[model samples]
Every structure is written in C-alpha cells, then in structure tokens.
Target: MSALRRLSLSGLATATAIAGVGVSTAESAPPPEPARISDVQQAARAIQGMTLEEKVGQLFVLFAYGPDAHKPDTRNTTLYGVPTPAEVVAKYKPGGWIYFNGRGNVESPTQLATYSNQLQTAAINTGLHVPMMIATDQEQGVVVRIGPPATQFGGNMAHGATRNTADARTAAAITGRELKAMGIRQDYAPVADVNVNALNPVIGVRSFSSDPQLVSDMTVAQVQGYQRDAGIMATAKHFPGHGDTRDDSHTALPTINHTLEQWNTIDAPPFKAAIKAGIDSIMTAHIVVPSLDPSGDPATLSKPILTGVLRQQLGFKGLIITDGLEMAAVRQQYGDAEVAVRAIEAGVDQLLLPPAPDVQFNAVLDAVRSGRISEQRINESLLRILLMKLKNGVLFTPFVDPAKVATTVGTPASLATAQTIVDKSVTLVKNNANVVPLNADPRKILVTGWGVSTTQALAASLTKRGATTTVAQTGAAPSDAAIADAVAKAQLNDVTVVITQKAWDTTVTDKLAKQQKLVKDLLATGKTVIVVAVRDPYDIAYFDAAPTYLATYGYAAVSMESLAKVIYGETKPTGKLPVDIPVAGQPDTALYPFGHGLTW
Candidate 1:
C-alpha cells in the first residue's frame, strides 16, 4: 500500500476503533488525500516567491501584549525595557504574534474582538501585509485567557466529569466561536495530556483523564469541533504528553521515564489521535522523553523526537511549534543562539516567544550561511507555516473592521452561555448536615476565609441577595486572635462559612498547611462550619472535621460568583468533583474521588 493509503487507513481505523468497531478489509478503506494538489502547488509557488529574509521571518512567532487589560508582563519588554510590539514588528517582521495580555477585557466579548482587530491592523501596517497569525492560550476552564462570561467550558477536569466525547465537542465548539469572533485564528488548547500522575502539579486539572483512549477521543473531538465548526485552527499541546510527570516544565525540564513501548501505549495515544483528526499544529514540550531521544536534550531540540518520531513515524505534516523558548526549561539549559539553531535543525517550524529574537534570528541566519543549517530545511518549515495560513483563509484576505469584531465576538448571549456552563460545572460534595443553601435566616450568617478577600465580588453578590456576611482572612497560623475573630462572628451568627483559597504560585504547600490549621481551629469551636474549597479539591484532606465541604475547582471571578449563588439557593450546584481527593498519604484516593459530586 502507498504511504497515503496507509495513513488514511490508519486514521479511519483509529476512529472506528474509538467507536468500538473493526475495519474488515483494505478495499473498504479510503486513502488520505491532501488539499487539492493545485492548492499545495500554489502555496509552494508563493513560498518560492518569498525572499530568504521573509522565509526566515515566517519561522519566528513573537510575543506581544494583547489588547486585553489582564495580560501578563511579557518580561521581554516591561522587565527589561525592550522594544514594544510595534517596534518588534517593524524590526523583525515575525510570521506570527502571540498575545501576552492587555489585549482587551475578557469580561466583554465585544471588547475582545475590537482589541484583536486593532492589534492585527498594527501588524499588517508593518508592510508585511501578512495576516499575522494571532494566537492565545484559551484552554477553557481555569487557564482561560478570555473571561468566564465568554466561555463556560472550565478546564479539562471539568470536561472529563461528563465522560462524554460529545460534551467535549460542545465545549470546543463554544471555544472556537468565541476565539474566531475575537480575530484569533489559532488557539493553543485541548491539552492532550492524560492525568496519570496525581502529583502532577501543573497538568493536574488541565488534563482530561488518565485513560489513554478517552483522552484520545476527547482530544480529537475538541480539535475537530474547533476547526470544523468555528474555523479556528486548534493546536494539540505539550506534545509527547506532559501528564505523567510531577514537575512543571515552565520552571525546569521534566524527565519522562517511559520506554518506547510504554510511551506508544500511554503518552502517545492522544497526539496520534489528534494528528489523525487533522489538527492544524502540534506544540513540542520542553520535557525530555529519553525513550525517543536519549541525547538528553529536550524534545523541542531533538530530531529523533520531532522529525523521526512525530514527522516520519507519526506522519504529522502540520507545523511543529516549540513551547516558549523563554521558559526556564529551555533557557536555563541552553544558550539562546544555540537553542535557536538546534530547534530549527530538529525540524521545528516555529520558535515561540523567543527570549531574544535578534540573537536567535542572527544565530539561525549565521547557521544557514555557515552550512550548519540547510536552506532547504528553512524552506520546509516556511512552506508548512504558509500552508497553515492559507488553510485558515488568512493569507488572501485583508484585515476585518474592529467594529464588526464585537458583532462576531463574545455576545451577551455567549456570556450567558458561559454562565450556564459554570452553573452546571460547579459540583457539591459532602453535604452531610444539609448545610448548603444556608436555609437559615440571611441575618444569621458569617463568612470568613482567605478566599473571601480574593473573591469579594462573590461575597458582595451574596450580600445583595440578603445574606449577612462577615468576611475575614485566615492567618499563616491558627492563632487565638484569629480564632477569636472567627468564633466571635460565628457566635453572633447561626452558620459559619469558611472559604479556603489555594494560590497558583510555589507557596501552595505552605499556604495549604496554614489554611488546614485554620480550618481545624475554626471547626473546634463547635459551630456549624461549612468549608468551601475555592481551589483544587485536594485541599479537602486538611479539614475532614467539617460536615459540609464544597469544591468550586477554581477561583475565577465568575466561578466565585457561581459559588456564592449556589450557597444562597439562587443557583443549584450541579458540577461533580472532576478529580478524586484521596485521604492524606493514600496512593489511589485523590482528595475527592473523580466524578464525586451532588446536585441540588
């Protein structure tokens, strides 16, 4: 059989296998077909028409602040006083632009669309006339780049609670619609990692589930829904699986200790499924998977992994992007120029968020001139990128009006849709004393915790609904003064509501320990204490004494608002705990078992 025939058969076989059916004969299977041969020829011809500089520029994806207000400090400019986005575009003419934040307010979808159009216009004005490939990390749930009012689909854990592929599709479709409206053509999402290691600090809730086949199915559905329904290119991310490791690559390189056979069975399934589904791109992880390439370099700079495994063995022809080059995983280990050259040699089509674009660009330029990197290789990557732009319908069209952006982007109806998803995704766990809905009089209630300060809007929302609320933060240690403050308020009220917030920073361990002690002290007062975990449910192991425990899964403003509404009988808690919370020191038990939640 031809390679194309085999690839097509493999894709069909995998899909059918997922649906629990078997292919009887090769004659019954169809071969994989490329986009019209003429389209490929036209793209190739366009690439041939480009100058060497233009080709090289197309391989660099520069980072810039989005029009959104909450954008992260790109650190390249603000921390170091480097050139701004406009300056970078004028100087580098990068192939793509990644929004760093400050693009627009996610709270208003219309604003998001308007901001995106303005940024794209700025890029086009650089004289490249290239419709800049705009990208964002809109991986629904807790990692949402856009606000909750835009998309209700929480994180992967929330989607996994449904355990239905169709649910994943629906979430992806909504995500695609919102992204396209904002002029975002590419989304780095549907984290294909399988949540195999419970101790995985970074990928915990971001992953769908531990089951390989299920992850594969859901990933395919997400990619398909985003591209087919919303016309946004979906990139399956952190490739080769970041799920099984405990450390986060954002800080350092994580090593995956799996043999080829093991990876093929476990870590590689979702990626394979994604490729088969025609995912537009795949982002290389910074972790080292020794089984595929034992040279000790991260997968982003390993040819055996990027070219040998992904491109040749897996037959992935789409663009291959590296995770942010500025990440400690890459920067701390490799020099900037060397990393750039090595990444290109390893078959990466795009270098994301390069720490020093000038240094990296010069390095690649010198490498090509010195015969260290081939011109053919550079052309190969540029062609793939151009194909992607053409496929997304960006190469031919001029920029759309920012005014029309709001009309297509997050509409009032979309925000309401997001709220509905949040309402359904909030799970109720351990209501032994029937403490929820606080059936008692509104005047007799005291709410206090670290979460209250961070989620003041939620507290205020509850207050508006007639719940008398006294909010206090739990100190670093459970002290007599802190206990007195909490107890005194509880003494004056009929119910004590304790909300605990877990920080996203490295202080999570120390902070969790402190919150645990505070919860214990609050429970010792013999008052009816309802503990609300406004972070991961894993924190529940600290306060077993509380008769009622609620896992809100996240601390986003909308999530907090949803939590408050559920507490006052204004909304029902229908979201189930997406992860299992094992007893402290238990191996299989999560802080709460996966799929454990109550609806009222």
Candidate 2:
C-alpha cells in the first residue's frame, strides 16, 4: 500500500472518534513518544509512503468546472470526462483548486464556503486524505474575483499613490480574512513588479510604483498582512518581474531585455524583500530575460532563471508556482503534455491552472517513470507543499463553517477601512481653474464614462450628496452618437466629470482616440470638464486638454465613493502619482512626473 493509504488508514478511526460520531475512542491508544514526530517528519514519512501517481498529483493546483462541487457540470463533461468536482478530485487528487471569477466558480460568500467544504470532504477522503490548498486571485481592486459582501480594497497602485504602507497592510489583512472565511487559504496577491515601462500592457495599476524601493516596502507590508495578520499564504507574483514589458503574457510571450545589472537594480528588490519578509510563494512570470538565461525560454520553463537565479541567488525557500499553464505564452512554447514536465524540471513546485490537468498529470507521472524526472525530485516539492499546508492550518482543520462567512466577510467596519484607503488614494492631478469643490447649489453634474456601472455608481453617489446628476454613458470606444449625446448633456450641465478607462493591456489606439474625441467635444461646449482616469492613469495623457483631472487607479465601488467625496468637496484629494504619466505618443517622456497632485 502507498504511504498516503497508510496515513489515511492510521488516522481514519482517530478522526471519526474526535467527531463523536458513535466511534469508540476506548479501542484506540496514543502513539508512543517517538512516533510523536514534528510536522516535517510526518510530511516526509507520508511522502515516503506515497505511490508514484500520488506523488505527482501533489504537484498540481488545478481548476475544475462547477458552482456546486457535488453537482454534475454538463458544460465540461467532455473535457473532464467527469460530471462533478468530487469526481475530478477522485481521479486527479490534485494538491489544490484555483478559483476564477470569470469561470463562475465564485457566486457568494456562503455559497463559496459550501463549495469549499464539499471539495475538502472529497479531497480528504481521497488518496492522501490531505486538505487541498483552496485559493483565488483576491488581489482586491479591479482584479477581485469575489465581489461585494466582501470589502473592496484599493489595488497596489492606489496604495503607492497614498504613499502609505499601513493601507497596504490593512487591505491585505482584510482581504486575507475574508478569503479565509470563504475557506480559501491562499491569495495570489501584492504584485511586486515595479512598473517602469509606461507602455507596459499588463502590470500597470496592478503594480505599486516605478520606484523599486516603494514596491519593495509595499510588497513586504502586504505579505505580513496576508500571512501574519490573517494567516493565509500570500503570493508575490511574476518573479524576476513582469512590469516593464510592452506585451501581456496571457496572449503573447513577452521578452524583458534588462541586463543582469539593470534587472538587479530595477526588478530584483521587491522579490528579494518579499523573501526576506517570509512570503509563502513567488509566482513565475512567462517572460524571457536573455541576460538571466540565454535559452530564450520563458521564466516559467527556464531552469537558469527558476533554479539558478530565483533559488540559488535569491535563496527563496518557499513554494515556486507557475502562472496559469493555459496562458498562450507557455502553451505556444510547448505542448500541453510537455509544459508541466518542463515546469517541474525547471524547479516549479506547483503547476497552476493547467489547460489539460489529466494530460499534464499523466505526463509528469510518465516523466518520473522514464527517468526524465526522478522520484526524489517529486518528493522535494511534495515536502514543500505539505509543509505549507501544515504551517497554514490546512492540514488538520480543512473544513470551514459556512454560517460564519457572512459576518466575517464584508463587515461594515471592513468596508469603512476600504473606503479610507481609496479616499486617501483619490489623486487630484489638476484643478486648472480651482473649479473643483464645486460651489454651485443644486449642482448640475454630467457623469459620463467608459463603464456604465462605474458611471451609474458615480451618478448615484453625487445624487445622494444633493447634486442633480445626468449620466450619459460613453463606452471605451464611444460612437459618434454617444459623443454627440454626451456633448449635448455637457452643455446643459455646470460641470462634466468624464471617467475614462484604458485597461492595462489596451493596445488599440482608435478606441482611446474616440474617447479622447468625446472629452475634447465636451471641452468645446465651454463646460467645466473634470477627467478621471479610473483604470490606468495614462488615459489623461491621451486627452490632456481637460482642465481638471483625477486618478482613482481603479473603478471599484469604494473607489467611486471616494471620488464622489473628492468631487463634492467633502474630502481633500491627497493621492500623488505612483507612476509618471507618459505623453500619449512618447513612451519615454513624462507629461506629468511622479508625485504630481493638486489639493484644495
């Protein structure tokens, strides 16, 4: 029998007796003092006893299709060859599950907790009887998966704009606590990349700052907040850095051309600080850095970068996780069957979100049997994953009380703290005519923006504050009709507050060009116009003619609430630019330097 079977059989009776489910404890006795080994020793023995298949399964944190863990998933029945999540767990016995909001895996707090418990029950009853590491990308801000009923905290750039590490710490703690309540033990958060490239398509508002030290300080604070404060594993992601790239790894392979010295100066500090602060995991980026490894392989498949640089030079002893294996960056480089094996050979501890879990699982198992990967190598990673699960309280107590999820998450006090963070981050970069703190009684304000939800939220908040608000929703790429309607609305209103959104990876110039046209036409109406870059602050550089400007760094509900307060003169705008605002055509030149902000 495997070590997993041994562990499960040995503890089954004890677990049943503890629950007082009519099992007699009188038939069992405690193990001798020698057998009362440390967690590390126990983990080692368990690994020693596990079969080759069981060992390989411990290396993956895959995704399953479903809202209810027990119910059949008709949509992915062909892909998984299984109906329910429980069946998936029985077949693959993965180390954990990664939830994505876009996948409909998340519905609400209690619902998610119920789903978590069902999965845990299925997972614990399987091969190793180990509690799976349940996790999500609960980075807050725009990247949040679990929406309201959970407090919306500001993203990293918002924290950087406030220049407050305390806010970063608080946001992480609250995020961690809420996630834990929903039975998620890990958070892929506190993006450590120092966004130095203005044309960076991926890590704009997600990154804290252009300065490495600021990013380092913020990363450390968030790590402590997530791990120490709320007792969840915090991940500092895209190691070696993904901030300076002009392309996104989700769709294309990005290459970072920094030399060894420049990388050490720019992208290395935050990761180093994260390790020093005892971050639980560091996620690999799918970008290639030729100076670190001349192999031209992405960091996710580069041993010279993962094993040589991240492990040997940086000395990160924690779990090394790969970014989603489904991403085109890694997939285009290798087949689905070969990618997971390559990642393991390259020194990654956990393969996350593989496109084909069954294929990758068998591939890794085949590699070990073929001598391409040794059993000893698999055991090394198993120990790290087991140790992490043990240390984070996932080993012993895996199930959570769904009853407590509502009260524990999205409490009024937590929401208030979230508001404070966004409030501090509401940056006023321009108030050309001192037109802000609008003094008009029964103020006629035209709220127009790229997102209908965001514009509606702002309009509602302004109405609550006694302003007669007119909402003309101009989408990201506003049509001629939308622009004309917005301009007509602006003429009748005293001030026009246009919220423009240029997402992190937005490359199409025509859409943004049209949005800029809407802003210019609003200005042509001789109306007081205030522009707010709600996503990436670079939107203002594209439409620089606006007399008044603000950057919320995000369009989260709490961010909109704070923006309303700043607009109505209820609160002062104190946030500075965490990144320099680059001129639209000039990626190298700055239109507004870092730390530019105006306040009443």
Candidate 3:
C-alpha cells in the first residue's frame, strides 16, 4: 500500500537554484526550492561573488587521504595526476569530502573530529568561506566506515527481517544522531537496492528486502528518521537498483537487463519513496541498464537516466550524486578527466571519491574554461550544493569541538537498541531436527569460519552461555591441514557449526565452491552440521544438506550476540528471511521464497 510511483519534483528546478539569479538562457527552468526563501537568497548572494575556480571546486567531493596526506612529500604513484596538499588547498579547493574505512587514518573519535575540523578549516581558509559536505558511508550493517564505539545497529536486511518500519526508522535515527555527533554532515545510507538476486555479492544484506513495497517503506522511514533526528542529509542510493546484479560495480560494470516498464515496476519503488519523502539526495548507480540507454553506458554516464529519467520524468527535487567515480566501473572506461566531464554533463551535481582529486578538478576546470561545458551548468550544480549546505546548517556552522566528539558518538542507549534489533533479527530458516535452542545434553559445539576473530567471537559468546565451544578457520578456502583439524573436531562434537562468510571478489564462486566442499566434508563426518550464514542469505543454497540453517545478516557484535542468544533460547528466533535462496540442487527454482523463515 506504499506510494508506488507518486514522487513529483514539480517546480524543483526553479526552487533549488539561487533565487532571482539572472541567466542568459531565457527559457531555462527556474531553480527548485529546497531551502528556505531567505536561505536561497543568501546562497544567491554568495554565488554572485564567487570566482570560476571557487565555483568549480564546489562540484567535487574528494577523499581525505589521511592527516599526513596534507604534506607535499607523501605523494604516491599517480594514476591520473594526484593532487598535492598545497595544490588542493590553494588551486582547486574541493567543496566536499567522503570518508571510508582507513581513509583519514581515523583511529579514534578525537582524531576523526580533529581531522574533519582541519578539512573544514582548510576549505574556509581558501577564502570562499563555503562549508564542505563531509560524508561517510555509514550504512550500518556491513559497510561501516567509522569503527567501534559507534553502535553496531542492525543492517537493512535485518530491519526487513523484523518487517517493521518503525524499528528501521529508529535504527536510522540512531545512526544519524551518532554521525552528527562525530561531525559528519552527510551519510550515504539506507541502501534502497532491492535484493532480487540472491547471488548479488555486494548488495546482499545491505538491501532491505526482495519485496519492492517492503524496500520502499523501509527506505522512506530511514530517510525521514535521519533528517528528523540528526538533521543530516540521508542519501537514497545505488539508484535503479543494484539488487539484481551478479557483479559489483566497485570492480566492474554490471548491466541490468530490465526494460523501462520493468524498471518502473521493481527497482524504481524505493527511490520513488525516497523522493516523495523529501529525501535530500539520490546517488547514481554505476550499473548499465540497456532499457534506458542502449549505448551500454552505466547510469552514472547516461544522460537519459540522470537528466531525462531522474530529473525530468521522476521530478527529483534535490541533488543527484554520482557513485564513487574512482570505482573501476567508470574508472576503467574513462580517464579521470572524462569521468568528471561526462558525469557533470549527465547532470550529476556532486562527484564522489575521484581517483585523483587534482586531476579531476583540473579536467573539469579546463572543460568549463574551454566552453565544452558551460559556466551556467557549473552554476546549476553549485546552487544545489550551496542549498544543501544551507539546509543542513553547514554554511554558517562549520566547526566541530574535538573534545566532544568521542563523548557524543556512542551511547549505552543506542547499543541497547542495537542489541534489541539484533535479538529480533537473527533469522532461523530451517531446523530439520529442531537442532537449534541446543536441547542436547552437555552440548559441545565447534564453530568454523573465514575470520578467526569472528569464529572465536561466536564461540566465546556461546561459551558464556555454558556450552563447550571451539573455533576453527573460516573455511573459505580451507587448507588440507585445516580441513583435517576441523574434521577431527567435528567427529568429537555433537554439532559442527559452519559460520559461512561471503567473499567480495571476482573469484567469489570459486571461494563458495571451496566452502561448499568443506561443509559437505563436515557432513561426511556423520555429525550434525549447523550452517550459520553470518553474511549472505544465499549461503544456505550452497550447503542445504546441513541439518540446520541460520542467517544473522551481519557480523557485528550485536549480530554475534544474537546468534549466541538464539542458540541457547535466551533470545527466541523470531526473524523471517527477507530474501529467497535458490532451491537446493535446483538452480532454476526458488525453494525458500522472500519472507520465508522458521523458528523453534
């Protein structure tokens, strides 16, 4: 019953642009209203006084390499010419920044806050006085850029397992609040990807559900939660869906084969919901949808998709961000320069994580100077960027107190909520012999997985509940010695629990094959095998012969605790599966459909 395709970005072009700015194009659509009338006026006033170099800088959102990266000597091999610290600050000051794990060498909260302050201070020092939109990929479940002390909330698929929008909203709010406290102004989150393909390596658990309506509802709720609670910009991302692809855009270009009509029906709902909910931004996916443009171009480089479909047809009233331009999907096809020119031409307001910031900035600069791309086009993007800053309280307030950073980041309340969500989301799909809630006398368990820490964590959590637990290797690509040791332990234990971890590699199927063989080998030991898919839900398909199957949907502490509690009946298995797995031994058929789950 969600709003299927009801988003109308009517009059957004005129409202979002700086109000009353005269343009040479007489018939140009007026800017859309995304900020207060006075804020728009202020933005217009500010734009009227900017230089071409300053305006060009507003289009880029580069990565903060690290604190020491500011020095001139830290330069590495340049793919596209890398920017020196001095050059970046003086010649091509970027308008925004994005942080991923280890990007800024963020070892602590104070360090991150101080570094963020330094970045903002540098931007201000460039004499433009414009605040940068510091964003981080804080999608919570599997993709957390900020490390621990930040609450490990249940991911999107976990939220889907509960089938509750209210809880999803709460989790998003907590994420937003924590992000704001850490001095990050924007979060690229609430992955609106619909997990239609269980084989999707990157988007499996990051997605909310296979059901379009469920994804739509959760997407809108999370966006609203972020804006309402944290007052930070929440992005609805990987537009047109990364859910159905077998490839990850991070490494390659994926093509979605759906027609326009088909696209409208399935991959389009969550984005529409985000637009209708007044979401601030929509991130472009790098996937190719031939239905939109037969040129085999990814959506990031496709004008038909960005301007024609998103800007015109869908009426999205805010900023349109390109997925990380450094990603091999686009990076492989074009030079760093082409990435910027084509993306801006395609109507992207912001370019994220450019491979080489200086090169991209220079490329854009030359293009505009040569009139290959007009100054007006740059102004359009700049207006949107300025409006976002104004609306998000960044234009006037751009500083963070380093001392308060750690104190405000994570709270016991948020962790408790995370634990509640994890407890509620540990899905049990199959218990052939009710092997769960470990009713066996003097239960002895052997946990094996890819990461020793995670395997040991699960074992430790179970051990605290009075069970004799031991851990083996992750079994991703188990060595013969490891296999022998695991098999030896398996024979002694009543149940051999295989904590399967999905790999994000071009060689994923081969790794899965190795893991499948290991699981089959454990089953050969004539002992009970309980397969816990700590990451991908499709894991059950690879080893369906096991006596038990569980999907934790994450590997966070909360997730491990949930697994422990579910095993001992401390937390009842109440979650339902959000995605379907291929029927065992039937690749052409779906055995456990979306929303299929079992509890004992």
Give each model a TM-score: 0.84, 0.95, 0.90
What range of 10 consecutive residues in model 1 has the weakest lDDT sum?
A: 2-11
- Cα lDDT tens digits, model 1, 481-574, are 7767877777777777777754222335666556676677778878888887765566667667678888666666666677777787777877
**lDDT of candidate 2 over 1-600, digit per residue (tens):** 444344444554444344322222222553322356687787887887778887788788877776888788775566678888888887888897988788778888888988887787788767467768999998877798999888887798999999999889999999999999888999999899999998787888999999999999999999999999999999999988999999889999999999899999999999999999999999999999999998889999989999999999999999999999989999887899999999999999999988887788899989989999999999999999999987897766666778778788999999988898889998998788887887647889999968888999898888998899999998888889999999988888888999888722257776757888888888888888988889888877766778888899889778899999998888999999999988877878989999988897
lDDT, residue 176, candidate 2: 96
Backbone clashes, candidate 3:
15
| Candidate ordering by lDDT (highest first) | 2, 3, 1
Task: In model 3, state the lDDT of residue 232.
Answer: 93
Top-lDDT structure, candidate number = 2
In order, the Cα lDDT scores of the candidates are 0.72, 0.85, 0.77
lDDT-wise, the better of 1 and 2 is: 2
Q: Is candidate 1 or candidate 3 better by TM-score?
A: 3
For residues 1-600, write the lDDT of model 3, one tens digit per residue: 001000012232232232221213222453343444465665666677788888888888776455533544344225324444334554556778777676444676666666666666566555565557888889988888886888887689998999988889988888887777656889998899898876787798999998899999999999988998779999999986888887889998998998788789889999998999999999999999999889888899889999998899889979999999878998777888898899999999999878777678889889998999999899899888888877887765555666666566777777888798779998888898887887636788898867676788788888887779888884577776777788899998877878777732235666756777777888888888888888877776766677788888888777888998898788789888887777654645887777788875
Query: How much lDDT does candidate 3 score?
Result: 0.77
2 or 3: which has the higher TM-score?
Answer: 2
